[model samples]
Target: MKKRTRINVLLAEQPIGETVVVKGWVKSFRNNQFISLNDGSCFDSLQIVVDRDDVEEKILKQITPGAALGVKGKLIESRGKGQSVEIDAEDVIVYGPANPETYPLQPKKHSKEFLREIAHLRFRTNTFGAIFRIRHAISYAIHQFFNEQKFYYLHTPIITASDAEGAGEMFRVTTLDLDNTPKTEDGKIDFKKDFFERETHLTVSGQLEAELGALALGQVYTFGPTFRAENSNTSRHLAEFWMVEPEVAFADLEENMDLAEKMLKYIITYTLVNCSQDLQFLNDQLEKEESQKPKNERSAMSLLDRLQFCVDYDFARITYTEAIDILKKSKPNKKKKFNYIIEEWGADLQSEHERYLVEKHFKKPVILYDYPKNIKAFYMKVNEDGKTVRAMDILFPGIGEIIGGSQREENIDILLDRMKEMNIPEEELYWYLDIRKYGSCPHSGYGLGFERMVQFVTGMGNIRDVIPFPRTPGNAAF
Candidate 1:
């Protein structure tokens, strides 16, 4: 028989009662009797039962956890003790042995914090592997949803000169000599002398470029890395993260919200169907971390059923004014904890308020619109109220502000005047101004943080734990 190497046989029908070869890193080893290996092919564990007299004496040390090995075996029906199937070895070949003294992983469970420190090795763990696999599945689902809807995927530039949302939270990029940085006559550092011949930074959002594409292609989305210089050390914050920005030409605020809701639902359902094993693993191993509930006791369907209900039901839409009014007059019900706090107009809603609004008040995902113009981005269309802008934030039960979208200020005169009012240099954005002069249509778009969506789907707490290599303020660990 030729050398056979297979990681997993779980996908095959009736894998047992026949001969097969197994190859993988040993996940765990027993006292010369049994071993488990994860070949990184499937979520299910493959069992390698070793009888004391069946293997060469050299095989003892080689069959340890983290060791690479291949076993040519008779595929016999499993006794169904540890697993559904077993491989009765006919020949064993040791590829490499991971030193038990140095390897961090063993049969014992490791904490997420400890695992995060060794990102390179963490993927070997069952939990991280499951999360990442689901992450990939979710990404595929997003593309599938858009592709089915005929939306084009547009590649946005990483290095952009525009502030995009005017959020000042940007990582500046420069190539001038560090020792003798160029300065203007007034002693201020001159950005004009930089490598780009002007100041530039990694994009904080892809909306601007996405808008350009949307204006041309009618509907487009940019899925790429977005950087922010904010020093927030919260579970939800990341210095560098990926964003999915979709802009639709001639789309208004209502249509934009509808698209967002449908997209989120589609992703949830997709992950549930494709990565059910991984998500179940995450829920059993990690999701209970939220409330100390055992995974087996909970039958959570990745909250897909809840979102399906949302798809069938109309999303609760409320104006900012109405939200404030409800908050001011409401009693402390289960869904209105924030109602007990001070309620006032023009005050930025806290995460607690957002959660309360969606979880307690609406008991579903809620869309709140028409934020005070001064508190909203300058690009947002001003409402008829003159004080509120056409801004919308979609808040989910556990994930607040999952999507932020708004209609653009299409009137060039008003937009230019708004820029001037904000003291923005019009000369820097002359090309952007030309878009308005060249027949701009009323457009809308939103930015959904990719990792944030994963968190909501996988129920992962920290954004750092969700991404493969998380980049945060002053922290970039391998």
Candidate 2:
């Protein structure tokens, strides 16, 4: 016979009366007669019925929780209330032993903090298994949504000289010897002796390079890992994360918003249809988690309902100035509840403001556009008012500002002037300017932080819980 049939396949196929091989780690053993086994194939575990008379007591004692087991069994209709089928073991083999005293994972509820420390072993748990499975479904949905629209998936560079975000928070990639570094006569560190011959770092965003492809190929998107060296230890921030950036030629800010809204809906709907079981499990888990909180602190809607709410209603659209006006008159700003007071039109919005707009005021996703140019990047198109840019940010209920992007300034003269005002060297971005120099038409793009989206969709409180191996300020443990 084949090595073993995965529990997911066995549960779905239900090949009754046939002798099959099942191999997995034991979740629980009840009375030495019923064994619950999980193989990471699905969130549900397979129940293995062991006849106490057939198996020796010494061998049966080894089948403790976390022990690896292989069993030759026959599938039959289960008499259990919840499950439909189970395996009747004929023979059993212990692949490994997990002593109850030594094993870190006990057959009980473990805190997420504890699980984070043991991330390598956390995948075996039902909650994490459901999260990752849903993550996979969302990732596939992203590619499918773009592919259906004839968008080319662009692979942007992982290392480059340009600081795409212009934020100066980057992890340097240098091979120079720190102990005996080379210096010029001016006492400046000589980058000529470095590996790239100039300063280079891990990419912060792939939007710039994706634009190059979009201008040539008509439409393109880049989904890849991005790095940030900010020393933020908060639950909302990560040192390293994944991003999905899509660029389109001959498109404006309105078209970009439309694309983003459609894409989000598609992914949410796809997960609901394809990963129903996982979503249901996560929904129940979230409900139990929230039940412990104060009544006022609990979420108004469930996980599945929140997802469906996103798909059901259109995102509210407003200008940054309009949002400021709304906030300035709101109770939070008037009562001095906002951390950052909304007294001026050009002040940047904070998380509290964003949450109020999404969760309390509008009670839906909101897209705030035409932000002040000084608050946005240099690439955004300058509005007719000269003080604002064609920048847009999509704010979600739990996750603030999930997507941020703008229409590119296609005019070569304006682009160069903005670069000069921002003190960005023209020579370094010669390739980027060339796109505007030759046959430049209107183009727009936006970037979505993948992990933040996962947190929003899964109702996960901490961003670290959504990603498999979260890289935080002082934590990189596998």
Candidate 3:
């Protein structure tokens, strides 16, 4: 077997006049001579010059768009316009032939919605190739940033007995027959016969388990898939998505906000420097996308500018009450333009309100804290006024609420009271309560939705487009 060089390496090194073996899917075949090939190593494709007279007719006929091919060729300076180097094919081998008539991806642009329906083959397109490559870079940057900060990477259970978010939107995991479930004497369906001998569901968050690790290890983070049985069919809602949850011991809400800000800046800066080529491609793509929209609806800044703005400046920090006040005075609210109007305090601010604070009000990333206790989770620390909690949400320009976290309620009695007030059963989360009982210290953490970050970085409009296979309300197709 001959060694094959990656297209990215060959393009970068430009080993002129050297015989090399390259294998990839054909991006395009022009006039039975020029072939554009890409192997997913990078965004750019290599141009192959094939002499129609030298190559057999059968071999030439098989080199269609989307066909897999191996070519033994000599690399040389290109006479073409886009690429600096081209390959002169000495021999051609077809690994697989894609019929041009039936192949979904023809040599033409396809809509993102259409490509999503054929996600398995969408990776071959230039847009998705750049998006997924950037996705990998962002994931790497996340781990690298945490490791440098001396945080331990902890793996939490996907199927958990406790409801971390207490939202009751979890996917139930059961092995019992649903058609004829066993019932207790009182007539309620029995969960004792289930796989775990008790009720369990896919975790909505890993903060509860991560807190245990943080207490033991000082700092810990969990990056894993989280599930929610939400029936929302909007572009931003996904039934299953990735989450990055970091927990720290002996940290207050202020320190928690600082960590979240630092981590986000580090990762975004890393992607900007390391994945420059892919980011540039996506930036131009976003520019083209925005050009089609009306001037009022288009983004205020370019994609690259938006990312740089996030890294270059300190995020504007304000309280949720302050944000509500600004929204009430804003023209949109006064004119009744917002879908959910902000009439008064203690109201749960929707995405429109969040975006207004970030994009229109501050014109940069904003961090809103000290939310009303009634709107936040029971685990958040209650303030001295007793009306608000030490909760914080980091909002980005385009994507609202990129991160949500807080200083946890370390007082066992307060935790119990809050849980009871929310009607959450105490027995199910006894272990969580135990942590508060035994030598508990103030700890803080936040959960960043991984897909939302990717969407912000890549300037993708839909959350489904950021994840490889989106699990939504009625659509779970690959």
Candidate 4:
């Protein structure tokens, strides 16, 4: 029983004339003499050459697309033009056979909508394989970036009684039977009898818990799954996604911005160096996709160029007030082209506005800080002018807000007033307020939606494509 070598390693090592064992699913069986095999190790597939005359008819018949096979072969220089090296199979073992008549995936192009329906099997496709590989690289870069900065990785609770974003869009975690639900004396559904003994929901963000860790430990980060119950069925929204949040004590808004900018550049640069092949494939994929669009709708820069731009240039920084003023006078708003028209000073910016700031006005990544107090969360530090908060959002070219953060309010009196004004109950988050009472300093943190980052890096248009088993509105299949 010879050990199998991954295609990626074999491709890189190029063990020419050496007998190697490889096991993978057959991507295609062409001309009964070649097998395009892949094991999802990388974007490229190994061409396995078969001797039609020597191979058994039954074994050859089983080499259909999607069939799993183990092959003992000699690695040699490829005779074909597409690949550099190939395998000359000496022995073939069929682990499983996929019937060509019933197999959903064939050797052809499939629509993204169709692929979403069969997401469990979509990973075998080249496009998704590249996406997921780059996804892994980006994820690794995130941890490595933080670890090098001496930040502690903290595991935050998935279920909590408090909503950190104050967005009121959270999935409730309950063990109570809904068919015959428990009720209180006032006829309201009683959550006190539930599993946690009170109301608790799947956490929408782990920033609050990470903040606690930061206040005590000086610096900390959390990487975990977060859920939202928002019914947004858009290209950018997801019901469940991963988040990367870093919190630093004794840090102000400027330090927070620096941390975010540095981290993003590091991650992008790491991916460019470590995952060059996968990035190139995805870049070509985006180029092909963009070619189908109208000339006016095409992106000015390619995917690789856009990523390099992020790493090469400094992110343009401006206050939220300045951003609002720019948007108000921009041709999109003045000419009635924006979907959400920016008509006032206090209005929240939409994705279109953010994209404009990045792609048109700044021509690079943009950071807009000091948001209006009323539109932001309750925990942000109130500015001296009393009308705004020390909040910031990092906007990218294709994606709107990739990261949103704030200098947390350490003053218990101000925090309580903001919470009350925002209708956030203090009793619900008493422990959060207690941190301020004890020894809270000027702590700041930001959350990067891991899937959104993956989407941005991989040039994926739909957020659903980047995440495996995407949990979107009304669609949780596999």
Candidate 5:
């Protein structure tokens, strides 16, 4: 017998009347006659028609939801209304049996919170399956976009001696026992006795290292896992996530924004074209979810429309100072509607402010640049005005600040001064500064949280739902 054909391929190929084998977990078994099977390749499932009399009662009893089954059947037009094709089973094989009463997954609408608790089995659900499929497409498109732009994909180390963000929130990697840590003469825990002979932690961002690659190779990008030890237990934050950072040599802040805008559009367009079915599924799912919300709280646009808008229109570009001015003059700030009012030019724009700019003010994707230097990182290029850095943040509707980047400080003296001002150890980042001292030119890069991007594309409200197994504070199970 020929190997079992994946349900997605079988559904797409629709080889009518061909004898074939189909294998997957049972999604639904109706009256022990019609079996809905899914192999995870697509959102739709193949219907396996089982002859109630032909198949033994014992075998039929095992064809419950979540049970893995292999079926030898003939491809035929589905008599069902929703599906066009299905399979007529000749032989049924139970690879794995799942007790319907004991299985966590049943044919019903499960809450996102409950699904998260059983994340290991949530992949079988249509909602999560669709979200992850779109997530995969977005990730794939990121690589494709960078590759097409001739940017070399560079792999940066996960363990680093330098805190790239200067945030001091990094997961430490150590071999020393916590209970018996070695102590120096100063009575402090000695990192010299630990692994790598130095204190190291998981990387916060690959932008710093990718800058090194860009300086040498002209252009480079990194798509990898990043860690944050921040104890944020919110829908938007994840302890461990993926980031896409791209750096370009001889590029300034404007070019940086253009690249980011283009890359986002490319990835989004790619997902829209390639994953239409999945997107549609997610779009409908989102609409249903929104239907339960108050009429005033519903989104102005549907998921598909929101994604298409991102692709069809140009993102509005404004300076941070200009944005602050706009916010101050806007009704929200004037009426004290903002949670963190924009009363000054130097305060960091919170997510509420960003969403206001994108959703209320511009009504489109917006890229705000020239951030106040005091609020940004030390690596950003200080502007000619002496107050703001050459930093830019791309804000999207519904999801604010999807991309953050800046032109790097190319001058060694200025970079060193900023590092000192930020209290970052100069000795630890000596190698990073060497690039500036040796042969630095104008360079820029940005970091896009991969899950946030996925959430934006899929219309998933929670960042945890977009990632397969989200790592967050107090939750690391499976």
Candidate 6:
């Protein structure tokens, strides 16, 4: 058997004159003499200079844009303006050759919409490659931050019977045929013969499970896929999106905010430090596409740089009542015009309100807690005031609500009462309530959309473009 090639052993700068062997799919053939080969090594492909005499005629002819090759070469300096070190190929072995005609990706540019269709091959593109690399790095950074802080990594169940958030956004899992669905004598459908012996669906958030574990472990986090059946065809919504929710026991709203802010800052910082090449490629891709790009976004090399500035700077923290006051005041004397006019209370905040507080008024990240009781989650702790609950949503400059968290209603009476009020069946959440009954702690957690982070970091316009295999409304093509 042939020995496996040690890919990504040395970076271009590390060994300028030393020989290296890399196996990767060819990104592009820059010229007849130059081939951009990225061997799963780094975010950006290393440019390899190929001489006409050095490579075989048949071998050289077959090296297409997406062809996979194992190349043994010496790292040399490049005359190219965009990059630094280039490789001088000694031997080129073709492992896989992607047909250029049928290959979804080529040298030409493609739209985010176009890329979403060929989601399988989207990662080979520069934009998605960078975005995915950042996604991976960001995820690891989440684990790193929490793990180092001695937080237990919790794996919340995927198939759950309870709706943690009473948002009416769950995709029910059934084994019944729609053509001949089972029904009871009375007009009710029978769920007993269905999957799991009862009604069940995908979990929207792991906050409840995380809470149970956190109460025992003190600090716990759940990083997994969350499903929402809402047919939202926007740049931000995905039918199935990964969520990173960390629940802390015996922690207040202030402490929760601090942990979240620190975690965000850490993730950004880690990605910047770890994946520099990937980020630069993403930045260039964004600049090429967007003409009227946000000035703040252009300057950021890594998301962490922005987060570091965020943590160092004071975040704008105000009550829902205070925000209402500010919004109402703005109506009388408008300093700047807002797209969505905000001059009210009792209603849910529009994107305009969130943007105003985070992007305009604060000029920094704003943690908007103490939301109206009617608009917020039922499990959230009722604030000192009668009408509002201690539910906070972290809003960033670019994205409106990146993180949504709240102090859980630890009091069993209030929780059960709220559940009853919301019409959530008590029988379904027997295990969840057991956590409250056995040993309850003042726990809190936040759900962060993973694809949203990818969008934020890579500056991608669509959420579908960021995820590898996006499960959108009626589009699940492999």
Q: Please, what is the whole-model Cα lDDT of each candidate in the order they appear?
A: 0.81, 0.92, 0.93, 0.93, 0.92, 0.79
Number of backbone-clashing residue pairs for each candidate, in the order shown: 2, 0, 0, 0, 0, 2
Instruction: Write down the worst ten-residue block by lDDT for model 1.
Output: 298-307
Candidate 6, residue 81: how far the Cα is off, in Å: 5.8
Question: How well does candidate 6 score on lDDT at residue 428?
Answer: 76
Write one digit per residue (lDDT tens) for candidate 6, span 192-242: 879787888999988888888888888899999999999788778889989
Worst 10 residues of 2 by lDDT: 79-88
Cα TM-score per model: 0.91, 0.98, 0.99, 0.98, 0.99, 0.91
Model 1 segments more than 4 A misplaced: 1-10, 190-193, 286-313, 330-341
Model 1 shows how many backbone clashes? 2
Clashing pairs in 2: none
In the range 109-133, model 5's lDDT, one tens digit per residue, is: 8999999999999999999888888
Error in Å for residue 305 of model 2: 0.5
lDDT of 4 by residue, 1-478 (tens): 3999999999999989999999999999989999999998987899999998768999999999999999998999999899999999999999999999999999999999999999999999988988888889999999999999999999999999998888889998899999988999999989888998988999999999898899989999999999999999999999999999999999999999999999999999999998888899889878998999999999999999999999999999999999999999999999999999998889988999999999998899999999999899999999999999999999998999999999999999999999889899988888899999898789899999899899889988899999999998888886
lDDT of 6 at 6: 41
What is the overall TM-score of model 1 with all chains considered together? Answer: 0.91
Clashing pairs in 6: 268-304, 269-304
Root-mean-square deviation of each candidate, in angstroms?
A: 3.2, 1.2, 1.0, 1.0, 0.9, 3.0
